[model samples]
Target chain A: MSRLKYDDVETGATIPERTFPVRRLDLVRYAGASGDFNPIHWNERFAKSVGLPDVIAHGMFTMAEAGRLITDWTGDPGSVVDYSVRFSAPVVVPDDDQGAEITVGGKVKSKNDDGTVTVMLTARSAGAKVLAKASAVVRLA
Target chain B: MAINPDYLGREYPAPEVYEVTRGKIREFAEAIDDLNPVYLDRASAKAMGHPDVIAPPTFPVILGMAGSALAIADPDLGVDFSRVVHGDQGFHYSRPLYAGDVLSTVTRITGIKALGGNELLTLETVAEAADGEHVVTASMMLVVRGS
Candidate 1:
């Protein structure tokens, strides 16, 4: 993987879009790894009891999936100096084999004087915006 | 009960060292279904100029969560964990975290606000290296639903 040079990126450059599949099993794995046992992420009954349509994906999991898009594009996890997102909607994952999908896309919003580029991200699940004001600052060679 | 507004600006003691390992990084990467070699393969990471396998951008949340647990579980805070849900998350990193790093975090309650019967609490966790070099600052907003 080659490093993305700061001089090569334009303010409007588009970061390739990517989609992540979210299954119930993925939520279980993430819960174990992140130590977030919020029943809303796994227990459909509990989630619905809370007024949610179904078991929703962990907000952190959705955030991570969006982060993967930037990391993969830059070819270096270290390139990401900052990341943020507001959970606007839940990525509801049903108890089914198909689960759901979160589609991520981004564009270089700005090129900082310090050789860092600000990328504005968009994450949607089930045709609804799941993350808003999503962005990442990445350092380039 | 609503979150104690007086606890705003309260800071918790730094958490014990959180040692980053290849296995943990791998687990996190796999959990997110992120197959980036930089998070799992040292050779691949080296080729990209990192000292070792680097963690995903959000990996700091794992360490930050541990530090936040102190505040969430504090009796004085008056937070109802049963109704809490994640609202927002953000991280500012001075450098990417890598396997073999030992980190510690200090958590502080930054803000408390109530909107339409829902309580929102903001927490800021600063994670530093064992030597006290700042690594990342994480901000999280947790919303506790109204009964």
Candidate 2:
């Protein structure tokens, strides 16, 4: 069941904007789950030693969070057949109750004749672009 | 540290078979705060025509990154894990990965270049199902910052 209808999809239609909070604990969980235990993502000491401003969110974490725009919009997690992004900037997570906030939003870039639509995505952290040239090709009903 | 360009175009096979399980899918989804039923409920996923609970599009990162371990760990390649930062990532899916699908990936260093004293390494990982069907290909770019 394609939750997104090709006939109903309009180019330039806006997908709802959402914000996801990225905390150190979230990174820890993501590290354990994803098996990416690079210390820069969790250890503040290691992060600074390497010249990073602070412990940073895994680029994949930011990518996953931004991808929700497509999943939530299509009502199907698997609807996205293609997704890619350039890591313009790292999402640095501070050790605090309130961590970094990644705000994600997108629009229907185009509807392809191949039963899919292109979504142009934007993600920002601390008002700085985190993901550049983000886009996804999603199948429609 | 400068990377050895000789490692370019070298391919490494996945160290092990990565079995797709609902538990792993759920854990990954929950980790990303994505609780889509298609990743949690097998019945609902099957209802949607998926063989089983399907993984998120980015889930392949686990397999691809894991497969890259051997290649990235080679001292000759001169990759300093501490200095590496992700530059870009992409996934082209032949089809969604569902629970019960076993997979393995072959990782190849597609390119290595120097830009502003930083080493940019491009790795491409192609995943295949146990049945020999191509599942997806994940391409990644890593930037090794200048010391």
TM-score of chain A of 2: 0.97
TM-scores for all candidates: the values are: 0.97, 0.98
Q: Which stretches of candidate 2 lie over 4 Å from their true place?
A: none
> B1-147, model 2: which lDDT tens digit per residue?
789999889998988988999999999999999998899998889878788999999999998877688878989999999899999999999999999999988999998999998999999999999889999999999999999
Among all candidates shown, the one with the greatest TM-score: 2
| Fraction of the native A-B contacts that model 2 recovers | 0.84
User: By TM-score, how accurate is candidate 2?
Assistant: 0.98
**What is the C-alpha lDDT profile of model 1 across B1-147, one tens digit per residue?**
978899999998655788999999999888988888888899999988889999889888888777689999999899988788899999999988989999888889998999999999999999889889999999999999898
Q: What clash pairs does model 2 have?
A: none
Across A1-141, the per-residue lDDT of candidate 1 in tens digits comes to 777788888999898888889999999999999989989999988888878899999999999999888887877889988899999999999888999999999999999999899999999999999999999999888
Considering summed lDDT, which 10 consecutive residues are worst modelled in model 1 chain B?
B11-20
Clashes of each: 0, 0
Query: What lDDT score goes with residue A56 in model 1?
Result: 93
The whole-model lDDT of each prediction reads: 0.90, 0.92
Which candidate's lDDT is highest?
2
